[model samples]
Target: MSLIEARQADPKRLIAGATGEWEIIIGMEVHAQISSRSKLFSGAATDFGAEPNDNVSLIDAAMPGMLPAINAECVRQAVRTGLGLRAKINLTSVFDRKNYFYPDLPQGYQISQFRQPVVGEGKILVSVGPDNKGRFEEVEIGIERLHLEQDAGKSLHDQHPTMSFVDLNRAGVALMEIVSRPDLRSSEEAKAYLTKLRMIVRYLGTCDGNMDEGSMRADVNVSVRRVGEPFGTRCEIKNVNSIRFVGQAIDYEARRHIAILEDGGTIAQETRLFDAAKGETRSMRSKEEAHDYRYFPDPDLLPLKFDQEFVDKLAADLPELPDEKKKRFIEALGLSAYDASILVSEKAVADYFEALVAAQPDVEKDGKAAANWVINDLLGALNRSALPIEKSPIKPEQLSEIIRLIKTGVISGKIAKDVFEIIWQEGGDPQKIVAQRGLEQVTDNAAIEKAVENIMRANPDKVEQAKTKPGLAGWFVGQVMKATGDKVNPQTVNIVIKQKLNLED
Candidate 1:
């Protein structure tokens, strides 16, 4: 089901107020910085952190007679991203000068796309539900267009009390402005859409999708209207950096609009800023119409045109995206949908999981035992240490060895965790650690029976209770495992304890 359908299925999704039920319409204009070594029109370095204005070139500074040159790599990345989104690619697209004056933009006019964009219509599928974690329902959001544009420089306001500092390092950097249709109905859907978008761009290597680093950001257009009424005028919320902030901003803005209309006040179409500290949006300026920018084709650059073969080659070389990988994990590997989704959320995690499984050829027959370990133990360890999967101390081969030990019954699951920690902290082979520590599971029937008998004799009262309540058999099993120092296989301990207690089915 699409997000709209899912929301319609849930009656509680409708917004309620004194006036009536209202529906929120949301659209997004996401700016993703192209991952290239140099600026779009100049050879200036595109490194994230540099001395202020150190990476600027003549073209970036808008020097006299300086002309803009197209970055072929940026164009290619944009086309790849468009294809990944399943969007239309306009082989021929023109660049126009967006007339806007700001201190950060040394060039009086920002060169952007107006009438023609490199990539045309596209759609992205987002998963939506409560907390975005229930049954996965696909929501197809329409992409209006994806256009290539230059980002303006930063104006550092805190540097000086009297004057602001202009940093041209980011000026003329290539950005893909991906505009979406107003199909979102709630804050959860908007968050899910942004998350899916970020995952796709990261998987494609088009953009880092690092909102904290300003590599990607969103301009949210939000408005509210009565159910079955015409769309209301939207107010643009500019430059929300984080996904959490996006959801918070939408909630606050929708409520603000609803309150205005309920109070007999008209909603103003204007630009707003989300103040993360205050958790609300404040008016920046009136929203501008297309004519306000006075957009026209730039005389310096010509229209971009490419052949079908070029696009075909790009499509051929595209990496397997998240959705495809998730599907394969579910079907071929027999993984649960929740587990597959978690593994494929990040490329690094997915690659690590694939490598781990590849190292253990019997992973498929084990019903994804390796996946459970990676998700529960390895990821838990990494998260506790505040480290990324890339920096994991345990390698895939090492993890595979650990799984092999468990599958072969060389060590119990409880003992394997100790081995994992020893290998993670002390850095030794898992098998060697198990051997050196004598952590092998005790499978001897005689030894296990002796342990179970000892436990029953010591806990006569508990044994009597076990006779009455058969579920208390687990308590006797735990005592056996503890007596054996957790080195015995839990299954063997359970069988022996059940037989000794005469509780065997």
Candidate 2:
């Protein structure tokens, strides 16, 4: 077997079917639009939301006299993305004509790369499972190749009853098709792999990786077989817009295959479209073999050639990617693997965490506290508010201020959360809020002692029970804090409550 097909599926990831257990094998071809102002072979505007055909140039329209001139920025971006994938960069690669008929394709054939792509094999290490407990099962997904190509326009079939309208705003727009080896087995693995791949492209700044914008999408190839058997016939699910939908399509298709096999039915190799509303895959057409396209080298464009320095410069400018940053967070800052993974999942989230740590110097030693607040509190609040991290009401400085107060015993954790809600709703300096509102924890020994003594006096019956059943001291502690408006640190209240009740720690 080739290196890409060498591995066996994890027994745990096998799907439990009607009659027996089956294994699923998945491969993905992710088409990511190159982040550029112009199209790949023409100076046509690549802007979205423009009037139909307004962004297209004479070349994009394939006019008789027009010649193809590649945008250098698109090529540079493709190369930079290849380097970011940790894939080998080919010094030379050729563009070929993919012959096909489509309503939206202005050119009779799509100018694309084949045989020798710009990028070679690469691997992305994805961690699956709960993504917590500082625990994960790492799976290495192989990237077969990344080829540069042009995107077709959108066909607006709903605009007319029988006639169709073509919007060439996206025509000739640059794209990088990153194909993965058949290394994924389960829907969860496919989801994680897609997420990590998107994360990489986003980190590289080559593609925005926005599926909703039609800037990025995936074609999933799914096949199923019994354990210890060869690969079975695969069906391709086309243009799954969302990562969630990708998983849904795979789950539905794999089960369909398993059920068909169990019932003694043969599988057909076909291209299918995922009906997300119905949660199933429907046949689109017969799956095309490579020879069906009749691929031939494009006569208009020359081969893409770049030197080592070109690739070297782009690699040198790359920012710390997710894996490296995650490693640093775990080793240098002492963050748990799960926490580190979460913090570095997005570049903005990682930036927020680093800034928070920079703001609170004490958290540098142990970023678990900062990670918890970011992942649990700030992220949770952002998600609830339907806001992105960039639109956060609580800045890094503002949150670090709250952390400072809690660490310094200026406010109890409970009071801090109250302050957090107040700050979350309306902006304010956390320290100033605590000072102005007298919200600081009542850490005074005399104050706690007085509250404890009063609770003992009022509940004389419970005070006796406290001495015998020492757990009743907890009841006294709560009542003392309640009597004092819950402004005191529970830890200090517990200590003094124990002293008043004469109970051991």
Candidate 3:
């Protein structure tokens, strides 16, 4: 069944309690680090894994009389990402000071966007559930706004016995806080929405979208209410990195809220932390309102302004996005929705598939075969070795050659697998491996006929049984294949055996 069909069959993920069913409402604020070399308002390096304070500049450290200067590249990246999302590009936006106190924050106030943001009112279409693999029932999640802000540093509490160390390497780095409206109804939809957003930022060359390395993170807001009632008090789950953890946190939080509301208890408006180890959310502190931040325009920096032509140029330079590429793969390459979706899930995988198709000009003939090899064989080997697609040992040209050998009947599917392994380990031409290893398929009609004859002669009783029970022909085929060392063409063997046994008609 399709994902939409499955969802329709069982609509609500209701919480069973004494009163009745409860509905969950969800929204997300995703913080994506811009893919730039330097920090937002400083010249410090933005490289990950740097030693503590090694990359911090005077501006990053907020030294005396150090003024913040905006990074033009960061601004361009933010604009490019906005255009990719089909968001409204405000020609003018303002940066404000968000007052907060933390040890890792060198500046007492964080420079961020409040009243005005660069990107406004966008939407992302996401598909949820395993059954919706290729065919997406798109749910349009509304994007409230995308604003620019500076990232704070890290605090290390486990390094010392009593004293904690602060690392300012990430301080003053540019972050795009993409806020979404409370359109997500389930954890599944929230996960899909995050996946879609990550793809867009990565494709735009704005964010790396590496959740493990903290390049991107999500603050999930979850609440529960009785059916047809008002929204409940929401709790914010902060900095859930992994997509699986995001879904889990939401599910746990929604149920927690429902339990409180049903037991004559009021849910608290607070910020919580997702404990991945325990699979539960613990309260960090009470959630603060906008007024609590004391937000005001920063006097050090001027308002950001640009012209329409600047936005147009950035839009023009965007590569074909995931949606566009997926449609092209389906329409032009004749691939199923599932196959196309898998291919386009990652840019590297999609590029490799395209290169393989380009290597062999007969894409119309070999496209589906190439896709199968990539998704099944190539990806399986890579996963087994725990290697990314970019580090794959088998080149696209080599894979294309392997597919061609199978299509041209030079090698059977089984033999091609052996060739693929050899190319992966030893690194040589697929055809050369086949030729040198004597892996060529045996298509000699007479030799196959003799093998079939010998098999039938040896297993006369089985052949007699086959004459009565036509399904027993498979035994003869398997015996012939084993006798020929599994190198014989299976189709030819089947045809010759059927002719000998008079099973053809």
Candidate 4:
């Protein structure tokens, strides 16, 4: 509603300067490459890992007579991304020339948007943190605008001992610059905002959101202010690729700003670079205002206008986003908010969970069970190995089979983990592994009774203590399970030990 009311500032996040406490205000300008086969205007290839200049065209190379043409697919993707963000879609938007001098930009002035953008103000609800109750606190990050622009080629300075190299392969590629309002207050909120933003774009299929390969990056604008004061002069941190680096840069820059301001120094508005290795932000150049760019309408491009039907068609084909999926997991699938949030954070993880549920004969009965194994076991194991869900050693059906085995009493939960390890190391059917390895749970009543009797008779001293301290029955359960090679259900052993020792409930 209001600016101060809209921002969710944590009192603890306030910085303690020499004089008083200060707050960090952050905004983000993220550049995401559109997942298209060709560049935004030229017909040049847009594939990554291409040879130097292999993907360039005459227009991309700034040949004398080459003209630029709009790529309709890039327009569609920007609109789709706009709808995904729940932002307003302006039917009529214009592209302007961003005049700048760079070694990588073949065109003297880059074509971009200034006043008119395809997507207008929107909001993203980001869930941050596990507070005291282990719950994510939801905060809304406002999107200012999203505009389409052409990417500049990459300049490789480390290719040789002294000489530099320029690769035009990335030139003329499509890019969507999404600008966020200065609503972020802390490093935690900044990381959560970036994470949520990346997830949304990945879900929309607009961008791959791969920060490593430079498919997505952010230029962080950071400023510091006293609690009730107006905004401070902001510095732009250019081209931070990783989320961890973003947090690091913000932390370093915020403290730098606070140290300067607290020492009776005014912050100079400038563009800076985050030195990830040094963990600091260094000045790149003085910040340029809109007037400095001397923005004018691009002579080559026409005003981008589309009908409402185009937007409606794209909206109808959208997939179920993370928020909707998380709600369904909680309401219909009986998953906890924490579990559902983790599962739906990534599309692949959610799909795997859904597949496990679908494979079960009883969805309601096995939903929580599936969640436990997935989150606690599967995801845990993957994280330990530094592997992704797509690269998991165990598939959904294989995990489903393990759950099914436990459900059908073929194996105990303890033994199921053993079976899981076997599958992880050596691929095999869970059912066959249980049967062939003699790992099935010993569910026979008579066999369990015999094992309990033998264990009790051999440990008379412990049995005497068990009569007074019934909790000693747990020792007997462990012995019996160990003698039975841990194949018996633990619940069954606990019951047999209780009955044998005459322990109270």
Error of 4 at 308 (Å): 0.3
Model 4 steric clash total: 0
> How close is every model to the real structure, measured as TM-score?
0.96, 0.96, 0.95, 0.96
lDDT of 3 by residue, 1-505 (tens): 0011112212445666678787778889999999999999998999998878899999888899999999999999999988887889999999999999999998998999998998987878786655634455668877888999999999999999989999999899999999988888888899999998998888787999999999999999998877666677899999999999999999999888877888899999999999999999999999999899999999999999999999999888899998899899989888887888889888889999999999985633577888899999999999999999999999999998998888888898888998999889989999888898898989889888999999988888988888989888887888887887778888888888889999996
Point out the higher-scoring one by TM-score: 2 or 3.
Answer: 2
Question: What ranking emerges by TM-score with the best candidate at the front?
Answer: 1, 2, 4, 3
Candidate that beats the other on lDDT, 1 or 2, i.e. the better one: 1
- For each candidate, the alpha-carbon lDDT, in order, equals 0.89, 0.88, 0.88, 0.90
| Residue-by-residue lDDT tens digits, candidate 2, 1-505 | 1224647767888888888889898999999999999999988888877888899899888888888887899989988888888898998999999999898887888999989888988888998976445468898888889999999888998999999899889989999999989989999999999999889888888889899999999999999988888889999999998999999999999989998999999999999999989998999999998889999998888898989999899889998899999999988888888888888888889999999888886533337778989998999999999999999999999998888888888988878888889999989999999999999888779988888888788889998877889988788878877787778989888988877777855
Worst 10 contiguous positions by lDDT, candidate 4: 1-10
Best-first order by lDDT: 4, 1, 3, 2
On lDDT, the stronger of 3 and 4 is: 4
Stretches of candidate 2 off by over 4 Å are 1-4, 131-134, 362-366
**Top of the candidates by lDDT:** 4
lDDT per residue (tens digit) for residues 1-505 in model 4: 1234346456878988889888899999999999999999989889899889999999999999899999999999999999999999999999999999888999877889989999999988888887889788888889999999999988899989998899989889999999988888888888999998899989888999999999999999999999878788899999999999999999999999999988889999999999988998999999998888889999888999999999999999999998999999999988888889888888989999998888887633578899999999999899999998999889988999999888888898889999999999899999998889999899898899899899989999999999998889889989998899888887888888888777848
Report how far residue 169 has shifted in candidate 2, in Å.
Answer: 1.0
